[model samples]
Target: MKPASKSLWKKSVSGRVMVSILVSATLLGTTAACATKSGTDDAAVGVTDDVIRLGLLSDLTGPFKAPAEQQNLGIQLYWDQKNADGGACGRQVELVTRDHGYDPQRAIALAGELNDSVLAYQISVGSPTSMAIRAELEENEIMAIAMSWSPDLGESPSLVVPGTYFGAEMVDALDYLIEEGRVAAGDKVGHIYFQGDFGEPALEGLTYAGEQNDIAVEAVQIDPSITDLTAQVAELRKKGVSAIFLNAAPPQLASVAGLSEAQGLDVPIVASMGGYAPQLLDTNIAATLEERVLVVGSVTAYGADEPAAVAVRDLYAKSGSKVPPSQMVVLGYAISAVMDAAMEKACADSELSRDSLWKVFHGDFQIDTQGATVPLDYSTPGVSPSSQVIVLRPDKSVPGGLEVVEKDYAGPTVAKFLDR
Candidate 1:
């Protein structure tokens, strides 16, 4: 794996570079004098002489349970590997996890319970859950790595999103379709999405892309609780949409593909990161997905021949996990890697507090996932690390049932949408 370039800490943001340098120099000078420091223990929320506690709030028994479980496993593997390497700095990292079940109220309670116990939250699973706890986290100066990529959360002080927002992903997908001749200007493009925050950003992106490209976009909203999408597919077919963008969960994507095929609507289908789950390949609609579905995301595919992907696979194997790796697993590993990088920086500065973490996070430091994820630059608030995306098609031959069709595919629509 490639080490994070030292130049990043000195190049991206001048203010941050100075801060980190000054802090590191000052801390190093005081290390011997404060070696036996004890009264200041209360100043560091989750830091001890030999441990640094982190929190993970995830959904373990809710709609997103499958991905949540995989994410948790990936995070565990990352920390395990870190601890095996003598941990970050001299402290052994500990992750305290809680199951919020995708409920905002439950997340609020959990945050209250963990507010003073962790240095930061390594992962917050849902958009709503993160929103519910945003105030408390900010008040307590806790930095949380949000799992949701909602654009609104992009600018939040207490939360950091490791990937591109759903809106940008949609824009990139549409741009790809238009560029590849899958769809054209003035054609009717249908967007089938869940009705809430989870799907709204995608619809915004599709609409924005449509306006820019002169493509007619139509939205078909689906209730999150509903599974069958035969009627929705039939409606889009009746509209004569030449291409469809689905912003729903994995099972929903499977249903749309299956029902669309059943209805003889064989138009090209593009989906957000949430749309392609590996388990869908084991379902009756696997063939349909393999034929029609294309997924877009900010991370590299699980089977990519990158050092990070190789490391993730080896870690899973070492843990004796019988289940195959998937996008969710890769996501988990990537998030952990990013957070661990920041944590390491904080430790090196001997400032493992929330403020120090935020400083390191927004510094010139760019997370080098070694090709596991889109390289992230948190220096700019509300801007994504990389607008470029990896486009993948469902293929049964791959371990994750998806293969890269294009790596870091950039198109006209991304700049246009982000600029807006």
Candidate 2:
């Protein structure tokens, strides 16, 4: 028999006590007039008259613990604001969180434990971890907002990703490099990436773009446990690479940048979204990042003057957080924003089932986060909502520590990749 869903509730509630208190208070006030019902009594797995529970499977004790925590903060902030304004269908939002430590096995186990207690998963971190649980999610008809950008997840109807996939991002990055004259048709480019599912799509994108542009691409793989990338950088440098595309973590990206500088290789460094972290600016490689790094992503940076951006800043300020929010916060906010829209639509339809939520997401709906991110459309399954990616350069002067270099850049390569 499947594990009891409530068994996981205690674990979920322990780590986020403060946020839970704030959420519970707001929920009581806002949902006071709504009739109470058991979560499993009527429509869906995790819905009731007074509450809608969502699950968050994160990497709180792993390599991505810090960013995952920031993401959780952003998700909490979004739901808090929504509950304050009167939650969806008169029900307050609640989160059931579990830490998987970026382990696929742990993620699978946690999914089994929480699958029956939540309406949907708001955030599931890591590519391989998400993939491990994808089958179970689909079997149960559970909707999830996946944090990974692996293109394979795009094919799963039960999953939705906020931004363009790594492959598409790499395609756009290569196209940008070519257009800017940093690389040419015959120039050799180096791609340094993680070895598994997380980096495969990016490698595919780079390879496709290279074939299209007649550029020679060389690849170097890195294990997730290896912290130092000096040898990889040296190998790429020896190959006479004109530019480097990084599909690794932020720290690894920093290591590559620092090692490259130490080796006197000064080519442009184009990084996938995984390489972006606001804290990277505070590191010793800040100057190197400013001079050479360009980050490509689908969401707007945190410091933009747009409505969504302003809202994020206001949310952080209101939360009384001592440190400033990061790009991961923006990412979490964006995911929650999209999920909120779907929930609202489902509630309005008088059916808050998983099927109803799925219909809402697949109904050609456009989510506008008021500049916090590029608008997303979920009309088509297995396809990215937006083809455009925003490119940002590190700038200490900006409040978010990065400034937009290009907005909505739709490179020919990404368009081609999307078409295929």
Candidate 3:
């Protein structure tokens, strides 16, 4: 296929077949009719007579390499099962993958390289990378499902993110702590965040939560290279914070968890989704995480009691892959399900072009992952599909190394923050 161009989209849509959403039985009936009507394989970039291709911009060898691999496995697993079931629109789905090593420039270069070869990007791994490529994606009319939860993602109509942003996640986490009697309105809360996209947005949410509840929030911003949390933890300890919120990676999480225990800063350590890694259970800080840490996010926890979560676990187990349980896998599968639905919608609409797929993303459609995540609605631009989040705690026994503490949680402050 040629690179995406205005002429290509124009030609592809020249012969179109309009249709509404249909059930499985009716959908099968209409699939052939639409193809027959269109009468040409020039339907869109990244699609051919017998195959549909989607791009995966992943991080295979970077700071997030472990989770990235697990996520890649989930993506492959979903497509493998999908192909076995006869694929979308009677065409096999293929992933055109590129690893950016979690670097923004590399991500941009890869996206430019794959622009015309895939219908859409099924995965864009990092917040900075997603933001860096946002303008190019809009110009090219390509849709992408960015895995990062940076609040800035909502500004782009072409990008589809799975759950609430980092800001809202922190807000909900605060609410969970307050409800659990770990924190109260009169107390001070400390937040240690990276100074960039990931941590800054979370600090916004924490600040908003504190303001709404009349609580004081102590902000401690750290650079990514700073691994030790001794000074930050000591500062918060002096402030006598009721609880601490973290928006850093696993190594930082370890420092905070371990140092807090040693220093006797007894408080619930709430974290954003990026904070905890499943491998932490094998570390010396495992008991500390289990006792005080609470990880919050919009995605469902691995080994969650939900049927969809259980089904994914079973699927992975049946695949016989040696990779241990990780929430990243569940996330990968869930996002793929979202993209798969959009592709089918575009195909059913009888115009499987980049333009049509872009429309499907911004159109009025609700995606149900059957419980793997909150049902998603991307109809409204600049808004998250759902505000609901799940609170999790470290548990070695669980397949994902974390168990759901609150399955469906949307705190009082979330709606206000999102609106603002």
Candidate 4:
């Protein structure tokens, strides 16, 4: 079961009948069906005669590395496990990857590389790159499973993201927190976010949720270039806020987490998906978080209840991830599942085109809101899941999500108002 709060994706190769051809990516993006192209090994565009190829462009060493590396590993692992066992449709799946350094320009070039190799593509980690390559994606009609929550990107036909916009989910999370008394009524809310379209949606989600819920919310923009967070934290504190939401990358996220702990503010330090510290799972740092500063997370947290997730941790240990296992690591496993399913669909339909692949990426699917109580089925068109999110706080039994919370609060579907 994959966790909600966005995801990265992948699949495997091998165990398939050899097509006797090794297609080159340069001629792979031709839209029309290649009933017969040429170059038995390097088929021209639209020419499908075996050998399924996949391309992944992720932030290998940038802000998104933590998650992207996991995604890449998961994809590699899936291919390794599958090819050894047999790839989708008995046809070997080939995966090619490039490091984007989380730069948009690099992402654009990488996108071309991806299009040249496979009919479908999965771009993970960071929205800057996603935004940079958005237009090109549409022009090329590449099938994608990116992990950003920007609503604007959703409008494009090529995108196939898990669930829907994080904006709505954030609203749901805020409402759940307030109604549960996690926050008091009329309390001031402050947000510290990175500037750009990447951070815009989360801020919008917060902005919308607070407005609709009657909470006073303020925005505090932080430049990635800035090294410290004292000024921002102090300013938000001055606003009389009882809680603060952080929308930033690793650098700023670490700064915020460290500063908040050092400041010793009583205010809750709520975090966006990006703000949660994936590297702090094994450190004493988790113990330092303000008691109420829980970050929002999907059900795949390091402490989730599922056995599969447990298996993922074991795999992490076996594979040797430098950073102790965390929710982000498990998230890589989830992305693999999604990609595997997409690959299967691509092979089966004989339509290795991106448009065809998107048609079945999630297998007529829906996620249970990242493993929520009630299954969110996105199998049908226009229908998707609305899984629950959990609060990531220190001293809590679980790091984040409802994996360790009382059963009732584990997810949005698991109501806390049963008596009512």
- How accurate locally is residue 25 in candidate 2, as Cα lDDT from 0 to 100? 24
Tell me the tens digit of each residue's lDDT in model 2 across 118-219: 999999998888989988987777889888777677667677878777787888889999999999998999998888766888898889999999999999
In terms of lDDT, the poorest run of 10 residues in model 2 is 15-24
TM-score of each: 0.90, 0.88, 0.91, 0.75
**1-420: candidate 3 lDDT, tens digit per residue:** 012344423433343333233222211112222331234456388887778899999888889888888888878777787777777667888998899998989988998999878888989888888888988888788889988887677667667778887888888888877877788979999999998878988898889989998889999988878999899999899989999999999899999999999999989998888888989999998999999999988777888877657766877888999876688888887887777777777766656788777766656667667667765666555666778788889998788899988777998888988887
Runs of candidate 4 with Cα error greater than 4 angstroms are 1-50, 261-264, 281-285, 320-324, 346-355, 361-364, 367-387, 394-420
Error of 4 at 21 (Å): 31
Model 4: worst 10 consecutive residues (lDDT sum): 21-30
Q: Model 4 compared with the native: what TM-score? A: 0.75
Best by TM-score: 3
Query: What is candidate 4's lDDT per residue for 286-321, written digit by digit as tens?
Result: 555544556664434556665545555555666665
How many Å off is the CA of 211 in candidate 1?
Answer: 1.3
After superposition, candidate 3 runs with Cα above 4 Å error: 1-43
Q: Each prediction's Cα lDDT score?
A: 0.78, 0.78, 0.79, 0.55
Residue pairs clashing, model 1: none
Candidate 1 per-residue lDDT over residues 44-88, each given as its tens digit = 898888888999999989988888888888788878877776666
How far in Å is the alpha carbon of 171 misplaced in model 1? 0.8
